[model samples]
Target chain A: MADPRAEILRQAAQLFAQKGYVESSLNELAAAMNYSKGAIYNYFSSKQEIYDAIIIFTLTGLYETAAKAVSEADPPVERLRQFMMAHARFLADNYDCFVTMLVGFSGMANSGLKDDALALRDAHEGLLRRILQAGVADGSFREVSAAMTGRAVLSLLSWMVRWFKPGGGKSAEEVAQEYHDLLVRGLLA
Target chain B: MADPRAEILRQAAQLFAQKGYVESSLNELAAAMNYSKGAIYNYFSSKQEIYDAIIIFTLTGLYETAAKAVSEADPPVERLRQFMMAHARFLADNYDCFVTMLVGFSGMANSGLKDDALALRDAHEGLLRRILQAGVADGSFREVSAAMTGRAVLSLLSWMVRWFKPGGGKSAEEVAQEYHDLLVRGLLA
Candidate 1:
């Protein structure tokens, strides 16, 4: 984290999240970092590289959070609850980074990093899918399409970025708790 | 729909949705329409005007769809089902405009249209809120925060724009039905 590379990624992510990947320029990123565009080149050759790196960083963070959430739980239902809470906690803690990831993914459909980004996304969603699949197999949850249900639950979590505020009426965990009840109950036999 | 102005808004919306508002240019719009920049200017003063017009158009369509969904239904549950179906239908029927509207709202956060756009959005969410309120009042739905439940329902429906495809494994209405089942069951008293 002490390296200039991580520093550059952090600054550029906030810039891209606010102005968007397409609209942001190296000059703006450089200005935000208080460095010359030449100095930025020492780390990132172009805006796209920075954007891609930020996405990877964000996704890696999500994967780690989801992993930790489920690693401690022995039951599928417990794992599912932990996963949702972890996802919410991650967003609440790193709101700007999560926002950058969402905005970048939606905007960079034609980018060279599309496949890599999508693979990471699928892997993150896979974590949730595995929990659902395990629950259904063990008779903890009813028979339902894991793929569809996973997307629906993730949508409920991700859509919070659109409206969630730090000091709003409900904390991120509280909102996730409500979503968890609705989803878990619906899946229960 | 026959007027050149309507034609311009349609073309601009697609362009803005695809290339984004900040990166899209008047030249690209004119080229897409096969009209010179001057001709485009005759119909619209600036790209901002065209962008604002498209958001208004999309929101108006959403309001009308939500209104018609509840017009004939006497029960809150039926109205809620109709509301979800109508939303899916609207998105299926007008995917690009909806995408354009989503993109425009995100990008133009600092624009002069922010207040107007938010008012429209709140009114649209109000329709769903009223249905939830009525359902809870009559002991049809369980006691829950109408505002939070409405946001959750809308999130389930709105997030479809991110992943819903015409020829996908499930149609928009099918997805809506599954979502309806999960939600209605969760809310049933």
Candidate 2:
């Protein structure tokens, strides 16, 4: 069985994602998790703590997944494509985390977790930027603002959460391939 | 002088965009607008009403701007480029409105304006789909999923609001042109 703390975080993330964080209550989360309110308090002190945990977990998970996807052994272009595919696959598998991150980041000003979330996001963006920079250096990619291009690519992948339905027409892998083709070819010199 | 109602909306949108709609109070909005709370109520019955007005105003403005940007005389590629540029310019010029729309749409489920907001969003996307379909039909663009491609394009454009700093580096036109070149050429046969 998963650790009770981990299970609590997972359930809390799902509830926060489905219902906005503001609307999701600890009682409801406890009900969904089949845990008593006292059980929840043992894992998380407050709803805000639960929300902060979700934000940190989601952002860190995304960054680590993408970072692991890229390899120096591959050509920079291939690495970039792999990074994008990893991102899409993560979003597809962790739909709740993706939604939580999106809603959390949008409301960051209201949440005390703003700086940590932004740092995680920036680090993820940095990984993409470095890949683009490498591609530019290797003459595989055209000259473009690596920062802007990285954001553009990240935006493309991140927006998948808004429309990509797991059981819907296109599988995540298929969508990733399409995006890979569109973006990789678009960046080629 | 502008209509008092329109002025109220413009000010409210700015406030809501900077501070979220949920956080922006009528008293603060009235203070920003130099109107008494009573006067604000005279114009908008409630904060929700002000938010609804902002939604209607922003979405309608975006659709109208994009509609006027496309020309029948231009080839499908040029029309697409024009459409993208027009969107970037609109976003840059109407920064507050764009931000308001983003925050509003994210919280649409809680707001009574969900259906209306979705309808406006779909209409805006329809314009892009039509452009992509026209390109595919005319052989200017390679075979692609018009609906998916449309969303992809809009995602690239819409995500600009998060990172685009007006005077920091590239102008909106420059960003738009780069995006046009990247996306339009990617779609080219």
Q: Give per-residue CA lDDT, model 2, range B60-79, as digits (tens).
A: 87888998999968987888
Q: Could you list the chain B TM-scores for each candidate?
A: 0.90, 0.92
Off by over 4 Å in 1: A106-112, A167-169, A186-189, B110-112, B186-189
What DockQ would candidate 2 receive versus the native complex? 0.32
How good is chain A of candidate 2, measured by TM-score? Answer: 0.92
DockQ of each: 0.41, 0.32
The whole-model C-alpha lDDT of candidate 2 against the native structure comes to 0.80
Residue-wise lDDT of candidate 2 within A1-189, one digit each (tens)? 469988888888788877777778999998887779998888789988887887788788889999999898998878887888888888887888778766566656667778988899889999989988888887777776787777778888877777778878988878878877776554212
Restricting to chain A, the TM-score for each candidate equals 0.89, 0.92
Cα misplacement distance, residue B22 of candidate 2 (Å): 2.5
